[model samples]
Target: MVNKSKVTINDIAKAVNVTAATVSRALNNNPRISEATRKAVQKAAKELNYQPNNIAAALRHGKSHLIGVIVPRADRAFFSSVIRGIEEIANEINYKVIICQTYEDLEKEAQTIETLVNARVDGIIASISKNTIDFSHYQSAIDKGFPVVLFDRTSDQVTVNQVVIDDYYGAYEITKHLIDQGSKSIAYLTSPIKINIYKDRLRGYMDCLADHNIDYDERLVVESNLQLQDGRQSMEKLLSGQRTPDAVFSASDYGIMGALQVLKERGIRIPEDIALAGFGNEPFTSFTDPTLTTVDQLSITMGRVTAELFFDQLKGSKKKHHEPHKTMLKPGIIVRQSSLKKGLNQENSPISEEYKELP
Candidate 1:
């Protein structure tokens, strides 16, 4: 009968006719081990079905070679793209990635962070959840001296490495675009402004209106969770209100999609009867009827830079105390059929001066 026991380094070393220590060095790609010997040890390990003990290795090196990533929702294309970028970099550096989805729930996010901490992951990257008003869980991680990096939905309360897009600028440009297209009484659609990103976007929207000498009407602003159904209901409520907006600027593509559906059902021509714009530049935005004009947040690049920041923290920790690093990338506005009411004369438009420095 064949032995069913698990194969170890000793088995590979015996098969390769080398010492157990030599096998270990070869498996770890230690510079002292010759390339030929490394190949021989690897082949023997493959033949013997030897599995290296990660726990033992981690104990010796004081690092698990595992990274934890937490996001609001992994199913979203934006978050998924960020995870892909993080995974790509982690793989190249011989690190393993463990992902956790918060589903926009604060309790779930806290539990996931605690679980990762208990697992002894080398580092963590996270985007704060929408319901994360209290940051005690994140504070616990920081207090424990664990490397934590924040991206996208971040907070000023936590001082750590962060990677984000310029939300304020992106929102300003989009709102200005709507105004330049002859949209008077523009409506703003958004969620809770407690989160820094949402707050910045809301500020940008208001600032743009003030800059253009447009009155900031509180009645025209609609605040909800920014869900699809919420967006539909919000639109319905907006139309039923005393003041009707000629244009709508949504903070999320999904919400805008719902608004678009309502407008289409009501036989309102886009950019004619009521112009529209959205954020996040999701894939479906380009495929929507009349193609939605939205802002591209550079999701993948944001992820890559975020991972790079973690690596920087790791490397810098050897010298002195690592200072917090903050990186903000400029977001691009995708001009499409939905918000281009003034024809294709964007270069010579009235708002050209405001957008001259923008890409």
Candidate 2:
């Protein structure tokens, strides 16, 4: 039996009775090679179990046709949906994706970028980790003229192709909804403001409160990691404070869900006692006891658009593309039982209401 790894172009050429050069051209589908020769060479290659060295081919072509995708975590529904969206566009263009997770660690994120760069991937698609504050790592890749498109968790500090949800709009709409439902002391559970998403969201919430003539209480705004455990701890702390919040607007679905569990355990009635809302319209948000009201970031659409943007920046021709651009997908409020204390009230903010009323 022929050693699978040992099979080479010479071996295939011998079987097909052609020179190695002819075999190479045929394998590469060069127009000079006849279709019959191409077929014969390909047939022999399959039968001989000749696995082509993609890395070697990429080195010769100067294009790996491989894209590296970086996300905080693959387990989350929002990130997964974004991946799915990217794949949909990538598959059409015959590109392969290599996904890397940083688990929200800045060090790991930097390392992953370096690793992908050294691997010589044609391009990269990334969502900045929550812990990331420095733009040097991302700037380095851009300085080298590497194609990168960032989605979801992106920052204003870096100049790169960014596709993200309208975070401020999302936050404002949700906050206004809670206010419309008669919530006065609204608690905002958010992440560290180092990241743009959280910062813009916080601004939106505060601005909405101010616009509605409601007092902006610094005591009501809690900052943390915005994870499930962090949510629980933040909620517990808020409840223990001297001022009990009439509503809660968390920056993340995971954080709010954690708060939900704590609230349920403490026998607190949702919406009735404290209206609750979160960002990221995660799948489980639909099935919770009183379904969750959250912001839909158009995750899949973000992914697909980001991939398209990457291709645009990629060197399709000699034409020079200018500086990076931004695409903001309009986010909508998914009003569920959780935040519908006063159903379908007029939007207080000048921004028109875009609602997804789910059962």
Candidate 3:
């Protein structure tokens, strides 16, 4: 029987007919080492099944080369796309990533942050949970000189690098599209107003209504957790009221789906009876019976920007005491059958023309 544990760099060095120092330099791809020597060492190492000691390398450099990522939910397509983007960039730079899900729970988010800190991860990237109000947990990591990059949901309480879409502008565009479709009475569906992204969307919705000289009817606004059931319940409640909205602008794609279910059950013709628009252009949005119109949050771009921000901080290019670096991406509107009441093609629609030049 072979003693697998006995395999070491020295064995590869001997096999490659080079000193251990030369082998180490070759493995590390030192510019001084010739490419031929590097390839030889690598080939020998592979043949010998030699594994580099990452823990020792980490200790020597004072960096784990591991990034911690936290999100509200891993199952959501938006969050998953962001993670893929992060992983793509992280892998390119020879770093590994650890992912954690908070399930929209504040306590879980806080605990995850603490755990990541204790694990000595080089940095952290996270989207604040809906129920999170305090940012002291994140501040603790920053206080310890660990860099943090926030994406999607964020807060002003913690000054750190952030990559986010223009939520206010995205909401404004969505509402404006409905109004252009001749939707006189539009209902607004959203989650808790305490969340910064939701608050921004709410502000945009109100502003769009006011811009079109429409009275801000407090009764038309419904606040829920933005769950599928909440969407159906909210829709039912709105229908029960004295004034029924002609359209609904939801903060989530899931909520829009729930609304669709109720509308379909009642044999309501979408766009003709009640138009619908939602945020986050999830994959399912395009596949629905009547494709749902929604906002594309540029999730993958947000993730890539987040990883870049972390690398910038690691290189000391960004000042630790300076104002937080904010990168806001422009979101695009996806026109679909669910919200097109004028029978116009998406390209020729007035709403699309207005936003065609946006980046």
Worst 10 residues of 1 by lDDT: 349-358
- Candidate 3 clashes between residue pairs 3 or more apart in a chain or in different chains: none
Query: What lDDT does candidate 2 reach at residue 169?
Result: 85
What local lDDT score does residue 237 receive in model 1, on the 0 to 100 scale? 85
Task: Please write out the lDDT profile of model 3 over residues 93-191, one tens digit for every residue.
Answer: 989999999998989999999998877788899999988889999999998878899998999889988888999999998899899899989998988
For model 2, the superposed segments whose C-alpha errors exceed 4 Å read 1-3, 30-36, 316-321, 344-359
Poorest stretch of ten by lDDT in candidate 2 = 350-359
Q: Which runs of model 3 end up more than 4 angstroms from their true locations? A: 1-56, 317-320, 345-348, 352-359
Native-to-model Cα distance after best TM-score fit, residue 133 in candidate 2, in Å: 2.6
What is residue 323's positional error in candidate 2, in angstroms?
1.6
Q: What is the C-alpha lDDT profile of model 1 across 209-273, one tens digit per residue?
A: 99999999999899988878978988898999999889999999888888999999999899887
For model 2, state the Cα shift of residue 231 in Å: 1.5
TM-score, per-candidate, Cα-based: 0.90, 0.91, 0.86
Residue 81 shift from truth in candidate 2, angstroms: 0.7
* Error of model 3, residue 314, in angstroms: 1.7
The TM-score measured for candidate 2 stands at: 0.91
Clashing residue pairs for model 1: none
Clashes of each: 0, 0, 0
